[model samples]
Target: MSEPEELPQREQRESTKKKKKTKRSGKKKKEQREGEEQVEFEQEVQSVSECVVLHGIFKLGKKSHDVLLTRTKLTWTPIIPENPTGETGVPQSGEVLLQDIFAVKVKRRRAAGQESGGPVLGVALFWCRRKGRRLEEDTLHLHNASSEHTHTWYNTLKELLTGFSNRPTNLKVFINPSSHKKEAVHIYRDHVAPLFKMADIRTDITVTERKGHVLSVIKECKLDEYDGVVCVGGDGSVAELCHALVLRAQLDADSPEKPVRATLPLGIIPAGSTDVVSCSVHGVRDPVTAALHIVLGHLQQVDMCSFSSHGQLVCFGFSAMFGFGGRSLARAEKKRWMPSSRRREYALVKTLARLRPEDCQLSFLSARKSNSNLFVQRDKDQDQDQDPKSEGEESWVTNQGLYLSISIMSIPCLSPHAPQGLAPNTSLANGSAALIAVGNTSRSEFIKHLKRYSSSTGQFNFSFVETHAVSAVKIRPCSLIGCSEDESEEEGDLKTTPFIHAEGTTFPWNIDGELVEIANEVLIRVHPRLITLYGEEVEEAESSVSCSCI
Candidate 1:
């Protein structure tokens, strides 16, 4: 009995020893990691007396423009010369308003005397009416007060302090990079970080512990404390931020107020393979070039699409990318999906294109879209508020269809590698999208047809492809038939099953440039001037066939 009692004590001691040993080992590993990290603290600029107000204008939906006012609050006394006649600068559409208010810390001593710690900052509201290319002198008036023009003394002070900023101060940056490209992190530190410092931009970097690490911080972190947010990857990184924004916008209810998002202008420092948003905004693919955008602070409002589900229909922001042949073959390989130590490689020729099936028909919205299998870029979308196509001249078929890509870009330049850009007639604020359709029978025909669309004369200029910046599309499965009528046969993919009945009303929808699954089909609409980004006027894309084929 005594021995048994001792045995129990020994076992308990052993268990405690094991736990202690494990804890020590874990702590050692963590310490090793900390010691091995070569990251050094870099000092950032902290304050600025003067600030420049950068006004960026980009259209979102058709006619709406997002106005960005960036500056640090300083005593702004626009030197107005003695001229009742005029002061010239502000655009024809804009009027300047100034308010005079005093912020005096005052206390009354039982109505006996005035008590004060300092002077009360008194603010007076002044409106400078615009007539032609000049502004009439600012007057103390509240007439025609709109939201943009009205502000309490407190808010005006906040705006003055936050909007315009000093070089390199009070900037909190979140850059948790997840890159397939191995060199992305090094590039950020070596090349990108230096440029940020040169701009006098102060930043605190947080390397991610895991996926969505940065996202968690963005969602809950006090955005008011930060002046701006910058991302450091490709479209995936931008997609992450967009997801955060979309999530926050819906955090309260189905549709929450967009929040004080201007304080959190999404900044991208591209360190990803496909830096779609970065390239599109600045028209430059290099990280250094991307850094320059931060200084410019040109707010451009690009279009974003929202997707949900419909009954037996698929929808998305841009397009549903269905790969055909080469593109399909490249993506179909499992190895390509895995992270590679080196650059992800693919066959120069169209190995993936071999999967293309000739016997296929495009069935959507009751239109029997069939022809020689080719690469087609949808150029325009007709008014959907039309009579449904009569079933008279229709033959329904589906399956063995190689690829279908759906997209609605506010601007034309999709990515740096995009062979074709948004249509010329299309506007960044157009509140629409462009569709690309590739229909080809053979690999040879597919390449030949696509070449025309990618050349100096892009898709809209080419005949095979149609480039339309439209609303959205719905995808459905139909009976597959042969080239001739009455030759319809049920293919495995086209077969009907209750569970997999090709009736998934909800699936993943691609927004911006990433894939996300929503509860319902998507109806991508351009939010009229929803956001503003730092940008310059984009030169029309010049498609050059002079380079090798895409």
Candidate 2:
């Protein structure tokens, strides 16, 4: 009787254990089903194609994850056995845009646990990670169990990165090693060169020896041999390169042997006292950001203002100014030995030492009337339209005044001092320039207007200031000739003569932060989309605070 009872109890114990096992299996299957549902929903939202998905395992630190690669992005899903349905594919740690990929290399490592096997392959993926104020490079290494599998993954990644666009293969880089806090060389080696290497771009780097050395090198170089020209310096260096390229293109156009229509595009890697171009183009003052733009083959057409004095191309740039702006730059250039922290203040003080208005005659052509000549096609018909009589008005509407300054800007002149840009409303390829003119005013009032540049609502608020959208403008300095009533009657009896000025008085002109030669008159013409720069579209420009100034 005791043996029979023991047998019955053993049978019942076995039945209970079998039931528990079945319940556990059912719970696991439910969790897996829910996880799959979440992954399917995420895949649908991401628009990932199932046909081209490449699956692999990646270990980031101690956590292991399963990764899926699409043509444009990589998504990683965490492999959690206990809590499969808790979190799905997280974008923060999972998704990486293919456009941000810089390089994919195969790294070899010892296979510790494998028996009689050679080195295992690991994929080292390097990419640009944009953090608040700058870019940080981040790398991820995925170890593969087999060498062949690692190579396959690497090849797949390479094709995906290369398939975005026809990226440049060879480039000519000009670095100003002595400028921009003297970090140009270090920046190139540390940030820019590694990126070029990863993109498989061959670079021919030329370190600038002197102030104007880049111009000569560019003129002598066979520009066609390289895909693009890069300047690793400040605004001045970029301006120099721009002028050289424009002059070279002009020379080629006049050549009877080889006629070229456009010049090579320019890329700027910011390293200088003032990186206004880089600030304006990339919306940041980071060298790595500029390098990424170049590697990706992003091209943007920027407006270039052509300045001629006495039938000679005196200067050309995206931004220029005469009067107070020019005077300030001149003063700043002279105080180069001053500490960087005090240089700006010193220059500002010197410029304001004597508030003297310049006697000048200003004239401009309305861009609204003739937009084609400024942007698209400078046809013969447009030239005919320049005739004042044909357009039912004077070709050049002249204004005479005692002026403070005239700033001609084609692009948004962004700088550390002016974070919102000098011409915040200006567009990059728009065939027009912001012609801001300041009339003679009290020193206190001028100070008020100047102070507005630091504030969003105040820059355009003053009554003595005027701004226009112009296609072309000419400025001629003149001597103030005060005529008394008696002298006026002696000379002419009919009409009272107003105080007039004589022509030929000269002052400085600032072209992209560089002081140009003193000239009696300056002529600036706008060329719509004249040159292509490596940047994003004008539509992607940073959105500034909007305020209405009376």
Candidate 3:
């Protein structure tokens, strides 16, 4: 060994071997750490209830929870402590965390292939409760495997009896399984029920039947006892709720017995076809995110508009319209047979096919000071004495080419889906209204403007469109002086027609995507911001009703 070069060579080889071994060992340790971290994976938990479910186990990441759940069902049995936790094999530590909780954990048999036949994921879960707060986290719970398909957590064991959570809200939920789709129930049970259990929210769920069925339930609700109304449906369901609000307001109008109507925020679950308002307010209508919004919604005032079709309390919104772009909506709805995209395409084609010049007399109170009345009155007194019967069926002909649309908004954006982005900045307390006229020059102009609206990149060119901040507007077309036999009978037709010094009615005015006959006159009184709707959606009508009452 002392013989020089040979000894040096051996030492060099050993040193190199040692380095290689150490590197391999360090790499193995790194791999192990990585696996551990994977077990620790989690989605950002916004729900405090969810955080509680994972109590005393920060070491077990959300992914681990999933893994544990998956193993028991799709793979292996759930992990159990060699010594059981709590009364039912749950660690005593599990009870310690839940000691602060007071919830009702409901258990029911899974419907035939339907899981917890209840609103829960067909697996029983109680809405959770915790003291002293409104917001809650989505939670997780552990269950024991059983031989019977009907076993439930409710009334099954002592631990279930003692370790419950308490909360503030008495919740009542209405789910229209057919709101926009048929799978709404399934979506609610799976994602919503777990959090309900962990947070221990008290809930009563009723599936709806028939159209406007929700309205019927809410009409009879002890509205004060329940803190909020959560509808697991789509816009139509939301519309029903709005109606309920209006009806409640109407009933309470004269009675001092009326409770101070606070804006009861609505919770929407996106289980529908066109969740336009939900998407507009919250961006994407994820069930989880929407549930989060439900927890987060606060009261803010938004504007409302009141209108009458001859005086029968017709409805209008902060955004009012009855013209070209609106007709496109009617057109789009017709192509319901096609996929939404295809329907949109066909609507665009038809709209282009029907653009033409229009003429009419429009009168409104000028935004500027003038020796004028507080209304728009045409100087056409000659028509006062003209034979009313002469202007009949041809009346439709006169108004034909001159389609009109008017929109009144407190802010520039009138509605959540008005070819504009969501969250239309509406003020419910501001009592102002704006009127805009959409003019039809030619098919080319109509096509150009419609395309702009569709792309969400258009602006109002005052050239063809005139906008006025005003109190009232009256429009009458002269092209159809003798169009219909009914029109020839002035006394009969004028009473229900769309125009009158104060009583015209027979015209069809489209209000907020709906059409109503003004069989009489219309004096659109702009009742400044009158109602509170955060994401106004269709609730704009509630304020409209209030203003019309005024």
Candidate 4:
């Protein structure tokens, strides 16, 4: 009986030990699955058909990594050594897109006393990473001891970079030293030039001394030597360049009948008080962002307007303003001795204080309207009766009245004052222009209208405001003595007289932030896809600052 009892106790102990071992095995399996899942989550899935260009072992920092180069990206995974248990550690892989890479060079390790020669280590990659609205540069180094391996990798990368045909290798840069607060030169040197150099881009830089220096250089310079033209200044400088480029194209074509599209694209670096053109193009007034856009070869074809007076081409511009806008710019030009911000503020306040409207006639050729009532059925019989050619003709709309402001914009004029742009409904290559007309309104109401531009909506909701999509516009300002009887009656009760120029006097017009004096009627026509600019389309422009002068 004692022996049987001892046997039972032994059996029970064996059973308990077996159960504990089973539980431990199950826990280990669960942990292993989770680790596998984590690795899968961290690694980008590769296609079976994707071709691997190169694979090698490289040292990253103190750890060895397995590097693989594919057609689209470069990936690196850390090598984890297996322990005595035959279990390996998980790997967290990283990758960089080939398109984001701007430059690659051989990394060298030099001795303290050595200045010229050094031993080849590996390759260093320079790239740009998007951070919020801007791009920041980053670098990665692959360490290796073999010089031949590093040279091979460098040559492969250089060949790959050469395949990007859109990237500009040579550029002509114009810097305006007098733009804004006189920081254009510094902005270019500190932000733009370094990026261009890193990308191995050759640039011919010209520091503009006077107002029209850029235009003169553009006219005489050998444009064939450059891939593009870069303007490092404000909107005026950009407009001047645009005009010069268009003129150069016309000269090259030797045809006055119609203007040809600009051959080379233009890049703008914002370093001014109001960088509307740059903001409109790049969606932000940032020099680094602009430089990156150019290096990456982002192209956007934008519509341009040709401003003509008395059948002579005055200039080519993206936007123009008359009436109150012109008066304010004119005032700002006179106060050149003051600081840019102060001058703009003073001009705005003074112009508003002497608020007045201009009597003018506006004739615009409207763009074809899309029928909003899609559900409505068209009468087949009526459609058959209409002439087919007549359907293609867009009718001209005419209106004559007292207007406080008139704006014709081919590109959305975006700035801090107007975050949504002065013409929010317009697009870059829409083949049309936004014609905004501000009819006669009280000073307070006009101020309200101006303030609404900073908001997202309700800008053109007032009864006195009108907006139209036009392809061409003709504006004729009526002299004070030539005003209609009803117009003269409307001006009788105003506390201040209308700010009208004397007979035969030149009228001020604000064309892309530059003041122009025109003595006769002006005609503006939109040319679609006229010039290629270095930027991407901006769906919505954002601004952290707002105008406080109001």
Comparing 2 with 4 on TM-score, the higher-scoring candidate is 4
In Å, residue 118's CA in model 4 sits off its true spot by 0.4
lDDT of 1 by residue, 317-388 (tens): 222343332233233233555553222334323332232332223333222221221123322243322222
Could you estimate the TM-score for every candidate? 0.51, 0.76, 0.51, 0.83
Model 3: what TM-score? 0.51
- lDDT for each of the candidates? 0.43, 0.73, 0.45, 0.83
Candidate 3 lDDT by residue in tens digits, 1-550: 4679788899999999999999999999999999877665633322322332111111222222222111011111233445454444542222222332333344434667875444332122222233221223433343323324213333332244342222225567888886543778998898766555554456789899887677678777777776566778765565555546655655656533222233455566767654544554444555655554443333344334456544445543444445444455667666666664456557656544443222355555532221122113222222221111222221211122344354544333322233343112222333334565666454455445544533344435436655554445555543433223223333211211221222342444445434444444455544433333433232221011011100
Clashes of 3: 68
| Rank list by TM-score | 4, 2, 1, 3
Clashing pairs in 4: none
Cα-lDDT of candidate 1: 0.43
lDDT of 4 at 83: 88
Pairs with steric clashes in candidate 2: 180-272
Model 2 scores what on Cα lDDT? 0.73
lDDT of 1 at 454: 44
Off by over 4 Å in 3: 1-168, 176-178, 181-187, 190-198, 206-208, 255-263, 271-276, 316-318, 332-336, 356-404, 409-419, 422-434, 454-457, 468-510, 515-550
Residue 302 C-alpha lDDT in model 2: 78
